[model samples]
Target: MNVTESEIIKIHNFIDLLNSKKDSIVVVEGKRDASALKKLGYYGKLCEFHSFKGLINFADSIASYKNLIVLFDGDRKGKYLTSKIISRLEHRIRIDLSFKRKLVTITKGKIRHIEDLSTYTRLDRFTVL
Candidate 1:
């Protein structure tokens, strides 16, 4: 398939966002998600939370930094977790969910979360909303 110029630009923008916060810890869902990001060449620090309490604790510990990107999967669990996390640290951190565009896919007439964006079409021209 042909990778559009806009897709390349979007990928670069995503990479720039990741690299801009290389010093801060990136809070993600689990190892798989982190691994997928690493495969995409993200070299920033990654922190994985297995539970809500753990997530809270992690957020509390990093409250001093004031820079964090919550890169969770695009699913119900991820949305729930994101809401919980945002509620706790809404004022303390700068959270961005731009990566969700990279986790969405169309499956059997419905949009769903696959392992990664590579399973579907490249998110070249779409916005995160």
Candidate 2:
């Protein structure tokens, strides 16, 4: 699959934005999701939503953060989890879902989980010098 230059640029910008975040906590589905973000150069705080017993604990764990980036899978479970998190944490935590939506669209239906993001964004492997 050929991704346009614009797509690469957007992914780069997205990674940069995540890396620059200081007051935000990224909530991913699991360790793989966190690893994918690490591969993309995000060194900020990352919490695995599935690790917590429930939304209450997850929200409490990240209560200190001013913003939360929920990078869940694009699948049904992901959507349900995202909704639950938003419903419980919306008042205190600022949530961002744009990245996940754009990522799901950009993958061309090849990927549904956040962990797969690295596979699409790894343009370096296809580049030739």
Candidate 3:
């Protein structure tokens, strides 16, 4: 997979877009996923599934938030979780999957998981051959 400099720049811009959403909480699957987002300079609220007591509790905890951005991995488990979260909280919270959609679109499927973002965070040394 060849990642051009232009694509990297676009991804950085997308990260900036995420940073702009300070009020929205971004949900990822685990600690590494959260770390990846931070490495990419994401400064908004980030929730990790592993840190919660359970799905129900997690949903209930963030119920008060107006917006949520699910950045779960693109694998089967991640997709399942995303669906479950949406079904559980769709009526209560404004779940924004657009960021996730834009991420998959911008990366062209290379970023199947949030943790994979680490590879692109370091702009100066990024090179894929």
Candidate 4:
């Protein structure tokens, strides 16, 4: 991956934001998305969208949380899910979509899926040492 230093800084800033909002639950489409965030050093709570029986059930499950940081993929399905979730829970709790938006901005349109977030980071097959 030809990741520039500026990109790494952006990703670090994103992760820092996640850390700042650590009290909120982070929602993703699947386990891989959650895994990527974990790999990026976010040790906070994570809920996978697919793990729920349905949208209502998902909402019910997470309704108790005071805040939620949604990070669904930026595809058609993801957008649909995001809107549906917002519609259902907008009155219930604070849903923050800023994480997803910042993720998109940091990747510069190169990455659309949360699972592929790591692709924007530097990959070194062998360290000099």
Candidate 5:
């Protein structure tokens, strides 16, 4: 499926949010998600949660960081994990849920996560979200 120009723009703006907060750590679903963000030129610190336990542990560890961004997949599992992580770390970290909406809307019925998005769209084509 082809991504619309507006969608690409939105994705770029999302990416820019990450870029602007260079010191903030980005939490994702898995290594693939991290890889996808990295391929998009996101060089900030990133942590991947392969499972619920990992996510909780990571959240606890990063409680000291004032800025934390969770960039999970748009699927059911991702939403569940996001909620859990937020519940665990909401006190100490700043969270951005905007990416979730943009990702879900852009992906529509095609892809479920960042890794899948990277697979379907070339990195160069991505602009400011």
Candidate 6:
């Protein structure tokens, strides 16, 4: 699996962007999604959807944050959840699906959740190698 230098830089930039937003809440679908991000070295606050009482309450809780990154999976259910969140959050949220979409497309069906992002992207592989 040969990754281009540009791709490496892009991944690094993505990591940097994420790192820069240390205080921004990362809205994920479940504990697995949050755990996957942790495995990739993201230590920011995570707003888990499953733990929330409801969508309205969840959106209200994070309304205080000026910026947010929503990293939902690209699957059917994931897409629906993402839409709902975006609709509820209005315009204060940033839906970052680039990494997830690329991961799924590259893996060719190996992954379907935020939890499996690292395994497919191998973004860590490039850095570690």
What residue runs in model 6 are displaced by over 4 Å at the alpha carbon?
Answer: 1-13, 91-111, 118-128
Question: lDDT values of the candidates?
Answer: 0.61, 0.80, 0.85, 0.81, 0.72, 0.68
Candidate 5 lDDT, 1-129, residue by residue in tens: 676766666666667767788557778888888888887667777887774367557767776677777788777898898888778777767887766666676666556777875753484455443
| Model 1: per-residue Cα lDDT over 1-129, one tens digit each | 344455545555665577677446777777666665666567877777663357657876777665677766667897898898888887878776655554231122133332363422245335341
Scored against the true structure, residue 31 in model 4 reaches a CA lDDT of 88
Per-residue CA lDDT of model 6 for 11-98, tens digit only, reads 4455556767755777788888887777666666777988887887887788777667777876898889878876867676555555
Q: What is the Cα-based TM-score of model 2? A: 0.84
Of candidate 3, the 10-residue stretch with the lowest lDDT total is 120-129
What C-alpha lDDT, on a 0 to 100 scale, does residue 102 get in candidate 3? 94
Better of 1 and 3 by TM-score: 3
Off by over 4 Å in 5: 51-56, 105-111, 120-129
Q: Output the number of the lDDT-best candidate.
A: 3
Put down candidate 2 lDDT per residue, 12-108, tens digits, no spaces. Answer: 6778877787898888999998898888778888899879988888888998899998888888999899999888888988998876776666556
Model 2 per-residue lDDT at 54? 84
lDDT of model 6 at position 59? 76
> How do the residues 56-86 of candidate 4 rate in per-residue lDDT, one tens digit apiece?
8888888778898989888999999999999
lDDT of 1 at 50: 66
TM-score of each: 0.65, 0.84, 0.91, 0.89, 0.76, 0.70
Residue pairs with clashing backbones, model 5: 10-129, 11-129, 12-127, 12-128, 12-129, 13-128, 13-129, 14-129
Off by over 4 Å in 1: 1-9, 51-53, 99-129
lDDT for position 25 in model 5 = 78
- Per-model clash counts, in order, read 1, 0, 0, 0, 8, 0
lDDT of 2: 0.80
- Candidate 1 to truth, TM: 0.65
